[model samples]
Target: MSLPLPATGTKRADRHWWQTACIYQIYPASFKDSNGDGFGDLPGIISKIDHLKSLGVNAVWLSPCYESPNVDGGYDISNYRKIDPRYGTVADIELLIRSLDEVNIRLIMDLVVNHTSDQHEWFRESRSSKTNAKRDWYIWRKGKSITIGNECVRTPPNNWKSQFQGSAWEYDAHTDEYYLHLFAAQQPDLN
Candidate 1:
């Protein structure tokens, strides 16, 4: 995986209009579930916008509402192009967007391009045979160290600690090398 580095002389800072609009963050799963599947869906959130609008809120920051494996509590996203099936679908989000617009309320969805659900196609390919074209999408390095017949089996380039509770190195039997995992052993850092 790659950590996109900023240009040598560039500074990028977000300054959206909503920065001063004063909004409330909504954790959809805990908001409400009309279907009672123990998981909240878009319809449930839509049914309650009136409550938020009445509260004088203008913008809503939706938690990781996109499809996820629920790892990292949905913050570790899987896909960037669609809505999570458990919550709803693209159409559901579209309707919510339109409805919110009618009330002058803004809907902001989360984008997690980094590590994805292991089930995500990106991660799937990343963990697959290293020769796969999709492998470079994420950071994959050998174990703490490697050597084959006197040649170095090149480990990850850094001597860094995994932010997660344990060492970041994980051996992949498929590729005979260790890959980096900055978070949970399963939650490898996103590119």
Candidate 2:
């Protein structure tokens, strides 16, 4: 069957919009501010939908707005279900999605699951005790001892460096083990 062609000469069915769509990345905190709060909010994004459309953007990939400590610029999520107050309320996000939908613009959110905030419930429970049921959720390796100028010092399990320019593993005194953190010490890598 022949697919209908739009004014842009692109077939509706033959062309996957996701493959050809102009998607813009919006870091909400650095974007427009409608409430003069010095931080971008959902209403700010809503007001800029028209500007994005004018710029030929059909989709937007939004940065993390989830509840976090902002250790990694909101990438270390503490609660995936809750929206950070600095960004907006849950209802505000819903409104933003609906407003974008009205203008035929798709909204996408960033999903960072490589590691979560140490304050996250799962991480907290996992680190509560070595025998905890969720202890295996995060990688915990035995620390190694290295002599530095005749002084023996406990070191991480490996010589790997974190992306943030530090040891990839953090020593947890409570658990007496070194947990892998590809990013920040607060972000332990999930097992």
Candidate 3:
């Protein structure tokens, strides 16, 4: 899915540098504090692009700029279409995107698709009473009240251990069900 290479013999910021274009990944909070709010904003990013350019990185990848609850380090996105208020307004993202475009530097963003933070609407509803419409959005099973049928698969359907070194199932209070967890109890597996 990669695009075609830039035209040959082109006047560019970095030549022969395409093979070794300067690529930079910035963690906004640690990069700069534009508003002095202890968080990095688009202006902060724009201000630092020169430093990156000086470092010879021809491209940049932003960790995450979309709106989020900041749980799981912003990997749990609340709204992909908006920028987190802690960061800046949506205009900031657009300005950053346009600025990067003008400099011929590519901008990459982190995309999160796993279960969002508990505060996210999906997880909130999934945690509600068992009959909630979004309950099935996450994996949940009926509690241990069922007697196994003759062919009922059980015991984790095998002996596969969760990476967290424990039984994979977690008890849910809402549905009195057991949900699979691939990590800590707090991080319910979205699989």
Provide the global lDDT of candidate 3 against the true structure: 0.70
Residues 50-99 of candidate 3 have per-residue lDDT tens digits of 67766767789788777776755666666678888877788888888888
lDDT (tens digit, per residue) of candidate 2 on 1-191:
97655557666676778767999999989998888989987788988889998999999999999999999899899999999999889999999999999989999999898999999999999999999999999999999888999899998888999999889988889989988899999998889
Off by over 4 Å in 2: 1-13, 147-151
Candidate 2 structure lDDT: 0.91
Native-to-model Cα distance after best TM-score fit, residue 101 in candidate 2, in Å: 0.9
Total backbone collisions, model 1: 6
How badly does each model clash, as a count of residue pairs?
6, 0, 3
RMSD of each: 7.1, 5.1, 6.1
Q: For model 1, what is the C-alpha lDDT against the true structure?
A: 0.76
Provide the TM-score for each candidate, comma-separated. Answer: 0.78, 0.88, 0.70
Q: Which of candidates 2 and 3 reaches a greater TM-score? A: 2
**Which of the two candidates, 1 or 3, achieves a greater lDDT against the reference?**
1
